[model samples]
Target: MRVMAFDYGTKRIGVAVTDPLQIIATGLDTVHPNQIIDFLKRYMQTEQIERFVVGEPKQMDNTPSQSAIHVKGFVNLLKKTFPDVPIEMLDERFTSKMASATIAQSGMGKKARQSKALVDNISAVILLQGWMSKP
Candidate 1:
């Protein structure tokens, strides 16, 4: 079954999807926060996604932050919208920084790193890949 991953943020939501065998995760796109629901609806209609994995933002001390509240609200919406699908949360402490580092290692120019959307989407892919690597 395919799995979808989300890197939720205030302004943009990053998306990623796993292969049918659940072996690889690929960066999809970054969607406007306001358009995420609609985007998910359309994506689900096209792809058979069995589950959703969302990044749960936490403070440096591992405490829940104000942003967690918004993420919880979004999770609630997802639960209500797709009651049949299972949703899971993964700790997202340094996904963004990791994404940037990955891009930098790839030899992408400074201008590419400036694109927050690209970094966000790549972060989502990393988040999903991390989860899939677990037992």
Candidate 2:
């Protein structure tokens, strides 16, 4: 079984999938919020996803972030649609900044690093890795 992770945003959502063994998490792609369900439905035809790890935006003081409301709505829809697949919310504070730092250190050119899609993908990977590391 594979696990999927998502870094939800207003304009785009980053997606990542783990290997069948659940060892390594790899960034899959970025998709628009409106097309997310269709995208996942297509992806599900080829992949057996058992769980979803969604990034939960939160403030430093442990309060919900501005985007949290939208994320919660998304989560609710996901639960309703994929009733058999368990959904988990993982704190995603500072993930975007971390992804940017990682991209800067990776030797990618400024133009490539500036791509929001790439950043979103990396952020999803970061979120998945953090969730997988939890005991």
Across residues 58-84, which tens digit of lDDT does each residue of candidate 2 receive? 999999999999999999989988899
The residue ranges of model 1 lying beyond 4 angstroms of the native Cα positions read none
State TM-scores per candidate: 0.96, 0.98
lDDT of 2 at 103: 98
Would you list the clashing residue pairs of candidate 2? Answer: none
**What 10-residue stretch in candidate 1 is worst by lDDT?**
40-49
Q: Candidate 1: what lDDT?
A: 0.92
lDDT of each: 0.92, 0.95
Off by over 4 Å in 2: none
| Model 1 C-alpha lDDT per residue in residues 27-95, reported as the tens digit of each score | 989999899989989988878988999999989999987799989999999999899999999998899
